[model samples]
Target: MLTRILPPPGPARLLTVITMVMSLGQGLWMAINAVYAVTVVRLTPGELGISLGVAAAIVLLSSIPLGHLADRAGPRTVQMWSFLALGPLTAALLFVNGFWSYLIVSSVQAIAYRAGNNARKAMIAGLVPKADRVGVLAYVRAAQNVSVAIGACLAGLALAAGSVPGYRAAVLFTALTFLVTGALTAMEAPVPPVPASAGAAFAVLRDVPFLMFTALDGLLVTHALLLDVVLPLWVLQHTDAPRWMSAAILLVNTAFVVAFQVRAARGTGEPKAAAWASLQGAGCVSVACVVFALSDGASLVPACLLLVAGALVQALGEVRQAAGSWTIAFELAPDHAQGQYQGTYKMGGDIGKMFAPALFAWLVLGHGALGWIVLALAYTGLGAAMPVVVARGARMRSGVREVAAAGN
Candidate 1:
């Protein structure tokens, strides 16, 4: 039964395993780092925020250049080296005594992390068959979610202990994961190089239609912040639901992703199908928002029921959006420039996340039920517009090819 569900044995399986290991460490660190920084390292919340903002800025600037490096050298080599660097850089968090040290280390770690991530995307493009890429990627994402859940559980144990030693142990364990994954990545077979155009190093930077598509995609993706930042606060402040429902919602979302993500991705390998899936995903989330808004003034039982219903619907949207995003990102890029294109695609999500916390807070926490209504409308508009944007991008690509043919 397990064999029936898992990807066929080969590069796909190995890559999935690597993703699980890496994400496990990431989850552990992510769950505990903010508390550790504030309580143990003695930084104020504002300082921590500043440090993270700087890290985000650094990643945005460095991703494309690091991806280009992967294209020039080999993805396997770049990925392995970046992970090796990450092991030490992550461990350095153990020694941070002040905000400056934390800021410097975290910013540097973000750069290395982005480099490895870009190379990993490039490696998948080079190694996985086009038909299987989305399926294999879905499997990897599922494995990542499962491993991260396990890691988060372990972090919970340390948090329960509430001691310096316990926190230090989690950090050390996270650092060890990077080393283990890096060694495993070094053992994988190298990817073959794709033949690229000799035109320019950053040709992807100038594709206006693709750039527009990315912006709209980013706007649609702010739903991530809705799940993470908005929902918990809404439950605590507005609804009569028990506080535990916040964690319950996350558990439900994770379970849905593990069970349904691969299935959701099945027919999305084509661009039109992917765009349609995204539209449906947006619709589902819109419904969820309305449900949640209605829960704001309900009684306890009704609020709990509404929250559960909203979580399940949102999970459906999450899976569909994720699957569609993966397929569209892969299909839109030229084969030879997958690394650069993937990096550019990543920037969209990064940009969204950078702004989403503040935007959602002001929109939802600031305005109450009316804010949820605005969000639903915005998400619906973004989803409805994706197909048209995709069509425009396709036309632009066709025009570019026609001009090239005329010049020849």
Candidate 2:
């Protein structure tokens, strides 16, 4: 099982281990970040939100240009530098005493992280074949999930020690891991050269059909919010089930993802197949939403059952969407321009992250039971629309090839 899941013992496997280590550090820092910020950094909730919002905005604006740089300079080179920069930038958070310092450090960290992420993703494309890309990505995702779970547990121990010092230790640990991961990544094989005709820097933006596909995929990515934000709020506010059920939902999600992500990715090597998987997954999510809504009026036993059922279904949708999205993104990208194209593809998720929290909060919490129904319908529509968009993109790609052949 280990041999099958991991890339053969070489750079690929090393990269996978590096990813796991990095995720562990991220998990540790994230688990303690809010508490640390409020207690140690002396940041208000509003200030924290504003600072993070600025960082997200910076990442959004810079991702494409960084991706273009990766395509031009090689993903390995870009990744190395980004990681090297990120270590110190993250460590600088230790000195953030006010809004200005926090904003500057966090913004630069966000840019560096986004650049590294773009290059890392492109490097995956470089390292793995098209047939194995989704599966390999699934393994990486599973590793991240497992590492994060462990890291979170470790962070919990640190928090138990005391808030201020413990949180600082966690952040410092994260900074050190970033440095280690960067150094390790620098030793990996170099990225293959890009073809000369990979088109202009932002050419991905001109592909209308691909953009539409990305937009729909972005909407689908909101399943993340469903698990992370919406369900927790909904369960606390609407359901008669115990509050611990919120934690249970996350546990179920992480467990299921770790167990079945690679299995779900199987047979989805093509964009059309992946799109179909996404649609099917969306159906599961829709059912979960309806089930979750029904829990509002039920007694303890039934409500618990409903929440569990809904969470399980939602987890299934999460795995499918992740696998499908990876396949579509990789398959659609031209080899020479994968870095830029993947950067653009990543923007879909960033857009979803930016808007889905507020949207889901308004829909699920503000509007009550009716909100869940609305969300379900919206997901269904997005799922149904994906195949059409993928087909359109296919036609467009084929047309471009035909035109190029004619010119030849």
Candidate 3:
């Protein structure tokens, strides 16, 4: 079990270590970001949200191009440069005082981070064979989840002081971690050469079937918002459970991911298998939504119980969706252009993140329990549609291959 959960000794293992450290830094920063912005940066919640939204937009726009660069120059080269750029860029966050500065710094960091991410994904794809890629990815993600939990706990210690000094300390620690991660990534062996045909930029955008699959995957990925934004708000505003239950919910999700992500990733090497996993994940999300809704009017004991149940179900969905999504992104991508395809695939989640806050607020918060029902139905419909989309993409790719074969 331990050997299965841990990445085998090689580039995958090294990359997992880098991922763990980087995620730790991210966890630390994220835990105190809002508070730091309010007390130190003196930005209102609206300003902070707008700034982050703009930063996310920057990342979304740049991901494909950066990924193309990775494919052209090799993921190793791109990753090294991104890490070198990130160290200083992350440190710049300390100087952000207002909206424009925050936007500029955050946008730069976002671009660097996304570029690094694309390179990392490409690197992993290159390092591991197709049969092991999803499991390796799962291991990396589980390591990240564990590291983030530890970082969050450490950040909590700093937050206890509630001072600018404490926040700065955490930020500096995060910046240091970026430097370390970059150095570690630079030690990776050179990437193998890809096919000449994979060199085209923006070619992925022309694949209609793949694009449709990405859109549907994006909708399913909105389960992230359920944990990050919707669940906390629901518990605070609608349920009688204690506030600490919110944190507990996150812990539950993390534990679940660490324990079962690899299991969820099994048999997802094929698109059909992946699609089935996604559908099951969607069903879990729907159930979780119902469970969360039931917590609304329950007494404290029952409310907490329901919240825990919902969170556990949601965690299961998250693991399955992530595993399936990784498989789909990797398997559907052209071998020679893994970076670009993965970049395109990642955009779906970014797009979802961009709109989810407002959309969920309107649905789950605005309309009350009925809104949860709407969300569950949406998950069900989207989940049900994934297998069909996967099938279509499979057929389309098969046709392309046959045409190429005939031409040859």
Candidate 4:
């Protein structure tokens, strides 16, 4: 079943390792952020909020340029430079003691992080065949989450034994992981070349399918943000639920995906895949949102059940989206300009990350009950729209077909 579409497990196995290590590094890196929050910055909720906002801003700012760089130099080169610099650069995180200095460190880290990420994903697009992208990428996601679990566990053990410096050692481990992964990435054979000029980044978005996918992705991200960002606040402010509810909900979600992602990823190709995923994801998430929105008078059991149900549905949508979007993006990309087009697509995602938080929270705060209704509507809308978009994409001409038919 798996081999029909995906590359053999042997080659994809390496990408899984790379993805797994990055996930571990990310989990440990969280400790670095926490340490910064407690010891040096001493930020209150309001000030810390601003610091995070700055971090998001830094990431959004870097994605486009770094993405373009991946297109130009190849993802491998970008990955190597980006991660090799981060270890020592993160050490600077130790020395910085003020808001502006923190900002500088955060910005540099953001650039490195985003660059490495875009390069890796773009390289995946380069290496993996079209039909396998979703199933294969699911393995990447599963690996990442599993790695997160391990990293978090190790960090806890270290802190239990040694406290603050133990956490710093965890950060060093993160730095080392990046260096090793980057070096490994460099050793791989050259990827397909990408064309880059400053203008090419913006130019690729003019395509209709690309624009629609980005918009749909933005709509979906709003709810996912709730899973992490807004839900915690709600638990603290509105519900009598325990503190572990947030962590518990996340655990439930990750656990479900780990169990089922492989089964979920195999799907009807292209047109059908997109529509089916949207329906599944949308319906499930919509149910979850309503349950969550009206949910009260809860034992943790009910909350966990409803949250896991919604997350499971969301995972379904993720599989479809992964396959559908990757197929369209790769299929539609200009042959000589794969990297540039891929960068443009990823840049659109960064745009979503930048904007979705305030937009989602604004609804929750301003409209309250009505705001949740809005989020539900958003999921339903994406679900509704996907089939139509997929239908249209199916009818359009890709560059691949034109070149083949025109051979004299």
List TM-score per model, in order. Answer: 0.95, 0.95, 0.95, 0.85
Residues 1-408 of candidate 2: C-alpha lDDT, one tens digit per residue: 454346566666877888887888888977887777778888899999999899888888887888888888899888888888878888898889987788898889888888888999999989877888888888888878888988899898998997676777788888888888889888888897576566876888898887888889888888878878888877778878788888898889888988888889988899899989889888888988888888876777898899999999999988897888888888777777888888988888899999999989998898887988998999999999988888788777777778978999
Scanning candidate 2 in windows of ten residues, the lowest lDDT window is 1-10
Model 1: which residue pairs collide?
none
For model 1, the local distance difference test gives 0.86
Error of 3 at 200 (Å): 2.7
Q: Tell me the lDDT of candidate 2.
A: 0.84
| Error of model 1, residue 191, in angstroms | 1.7
Cα lDDT of all candidates, in order?
0.86, 0.84, 0.86, 0.67
Model 2 clashing residue pairs (backbone): none
Which stretches in model 1 have alpha-carbon errors above 4 Å?
A: 1-5, 193-197, 398-408
